[model samples]
Target: VLVIAIIAGAAYYMVAVQPFQRVILSVGDDSVKTGYFLKRMVASQGMTADSVLQSLTAELIIRQQAAAMGFPAVTAQDISDYLRNIAKGENETISDADYDKWFQERLDTTGLTAQEFNKVIEGEILAQNVQDTIGAQVNPQVPQAHVWIIVLDTQENAVSAKARIDGGESFDAVAKEVSLDTTSKENGGDMGWQVPELFSTQISSVIDTLDIGKCSDPVAFSQQDSTTGTTATSYLLLMVSEKSAAMQATDAQLSQLKYKAFLDWLSAQEASTEIVFHGLNGS
Candidate 1:
């Protein structure tokens, strides 16, 4: 009986403990064990394993690359303050007892030790710092277009609208009469001055080639219906009223540019870095 029990213990260790301790990711000399990966997987419930792994890889890369780039240091106090603010909630004050209870409950829910959770928070803070540092480098000025659009439910409607505009009917009058886009239809389809990047991929591709003071060929725009989960295609007739080679971007546009710059930098880092995955297939 004792021999059987000893055998069972050994088997459990080999089957469970060994796999958890196995290295699934290696970046330079640093490694991520299956246990660590599993914890992240649990925290990011509903995401595919590959996506979670990619995010984990990006987080690791951010830490390493940001350090290399001399990004600002994140102190233990910073993490503590973040946690404290969370515990404080909407009201201003929080007592020691309240914080302790909230912290313990969070740990219990996430199934992560205090140190492990703190490490996660640290990674997040570091990633934000990296984004800010890289984002600041984006230029505030960009080529922009002053544009107007008329959206219609059908291609025939778009063609008819174009004909009306071409046949001496005011673009604004036609747009307000037949356009389906509520946001801009009331305002004579005026989208205001904007960079191409602010638009969708499909729209951005054609915006650059459109001649000023002329309407574009009906551009197809596909949209997914939220209630029915069905995709619907719409047609857009666009006119560029004016163009500027170097317009100063708005505050919001500058913010978006900065974010794009940061993402571009991160993508470059991920592309150059060689990461090895071991025992990651089954999970």
Candidate 2:
């Protein structure tokens, strides 16, 4: 009986204690053992084992941030709606039994119980809400360049127009006569209170560099060729009539800038967060 007990204890050590005692990886307080980690790596199919682990760690951090941001609680309806949205996107009018089967399959693939998966989904929803809220708070202060523009279809025409202006031809007359921009040509190319931020980066830079009351030389610009579906270049003649300091951003620009602010905020959070990974590759 003593020898049998000894054998049983040795078998237990070989099967359970020897392999799982060592840490393969960790994300903050959460540590993964070698056995479980290797299984996860295999389940990833093509994804690198380290990347999969890191992604999960980042999600954990995002969840913590979500909690601190006072995001609204995730309800059962939220999860149900999320799944229903998935169904809609997939264009599959699935039955309740089908959904249950899929959900169970997902649990099996993810190696998570229904409760754990629910928590993960809840955290995801909360994190998304927090990100959106932060993005909505971006109020970009953008300057308005009240400039007159003489847009031309080609550089040669634009250059000739500039030269004509330099040779004492009235800019207003030349703009009305030669500017291709019908929108502003009638008003003598008065591009009334142009916000550089609402335009392209190149146009913004050009606008920023122009002196007040100075006329810019013909600047080349590009647009997608609507007719031939190719690259098309144009020229612009800008005269900075009036300029103002930063003002409220336009709707589209505000949305873009706000999203950027949210990303920047999230990037900044990494330094303050306490995250550690202990693994053969991540120590």
Candidate 3:
């Protein structure tokens, strides 16, 4: 019985403990390279393994767990939807095949397989869903407004423009003839459908105090033009065209907020989880 027990212990040590130790030691020896790899994986919320074989095993485990939970597996259609959303945000376009090839190339560069990458993506989606569930309770409504603005290079110009408007010159004509924001000048300085939150609290307060169709006193704003590499202070004349009541938050938006809260909770949970590193000697 003693000999049998010894043999069983030897087999377990050889099969599991020995290999795990060897690979971990190798990672420690190449700590700089391994650290970079681990950092990247951590940033993406991916499991890190000391070797490629361990990485493959970890990926399989993640997939199996996800499947057991009936987590939606990413398909080509899902990838396409993801890409389309990204393109919409960036105002760019790429063919589906092109995106697929590019994605594969990135995985290869990062030493990740399709299954591993898919697992990471699935985890992200699940986390988002969890957040959505938690944030759903807060119904936030953002007030929308239509505004007309006249921007001038200096406070003096702003005061002069306001004086001219008060003197009965047409606001639209004055904006077109002299306002600095050329993009809005053609449309009579109309900035359509802006959320009140888009402006600073002070600016929003000022706008809230003014009645619709009334022009404001000159307000100073500082900005930099990246293209021209120019920095300047400007004064603005704002006219509120309309102020609409805040729109109720949709279910989807509420879910998104919940998901953010869940992530915060998850971070705290991780902090409390135990972590053990063997053979590093606190290095």
Candidate 4:
């Protein structure tokens, strides 16, 4: 029985422990071993063997699918650019020594070789490219609306502005006179034609419920100050002028759709692929 088990283990290794095999998450002619993922996940994240294995499996699936889709490969320059971006901070210039030390520390902590780290970066860039490509292709007919907006720094000012509008003042006039968003204020607060997504979900949901050419009462939301990293509650008012049932998708919206599309595609892959998770519970 012992000899038989040893032979079975060797056979499993021969079949599944390769980067170009029809096992685990093979795509076209590529695969990854269970050990390969376990090493990186355990070393870098301090994750349990089982959890790391699950993540690694999902990661390879996406990368392999991206490769199969013929997405552009990550270049050496791309890796360098990514490292440089990592070294950047809000207001600091990282020296070469510091960057090198930081990079090595990450490798030491994660139990990843430099080559392995490069491959990881490459996989990320490729996956992003795939997502962008799909998103660019997604042309969801987005609903659009025309509205006048008034943004005030203080609740007292917002209440005062609402009072003026309630007293039969023009929303356009009020917005242009007191709005804080300089660009929109210049246009008399006219947001020509916009998707509901132009604002936060709170504002958009409210807009969806308003009647045509109707005004929304002052709604409160918070804005973050980048320099100070502080949040401030602000007030907003909107008056709808026109709307469309569907229009071209914005880049931001397209980005969201693209990720969804990739997820859907990956799910489809799962259906057709043969995956065996040895020793993983409830897999």
Most TM-score-accurate candidate: 1
Across 1-283, the per-residue lDDT of candidate 1 in tens digits comes to: 9999999999999898878888888765567889888988887766677887888888889889978988777889999888899889897989989999998988887788999989888999999888888777877889899989999999998998999998888888988999999999999999899899878878987788888888888999998997676999999999998989899999999999888888889889878888888866323
TM-score of each: 0.83, 0.51, 0.47, 0.54
lDDT of 2 by residue, 1-283 (tens): 9999999999999777767566665545556566556655655656776687765665666776776777666899999888666754566577788778878877788776687677668767876787788876765676787878899998889889999888888777899999888899999989777677656778888888988766688889888876676997889998887787987777766777776666567667756666665664322
**What clash pairs does model 2 have?**
none
lDDT of 3 by residue, 207-251 (tens): 777788777899888778966759888888988888878865456
lDDT of each: 0.87, 0.75, 0.62, 0.74
Candidate 3 ranges beyond 4 A from true positions = 1-103, 108-142, 223-233, 246-283
Clashing pairs in 1: none
| Candidate 1 TM-score over all chains jointly | 0.83
State each candidate's clash count: 0, 0, 7, 2
Question: Whose lDDT is higher: candidate 1's or candidate 3's?
Answer: 1
Query: What's the candidate order when arranged by decreasing lDDT?
Result: 1, 2, 4, 3
Question: Whole-model lDDT for model 4 versus the true structure?
Answer: 0.74
Residue runs of model 2 more than 4 Å from their true location after superposition: 1-45, 72-77, 90-94, 108-116, 140-256, 281-283
Off by over 4 Å in 4: 1-113, 133-137, 250-283
User: Which 10 residues in a row give candidate 1 its minimum summed lDDT?
Assistant: 274-283
The candidate scoring highest on lDDT is 1
Clashing residue pairs, candidate 3? 131-258, 131-259, 132-255, 132-259, 134-258, 135-257, 135-258
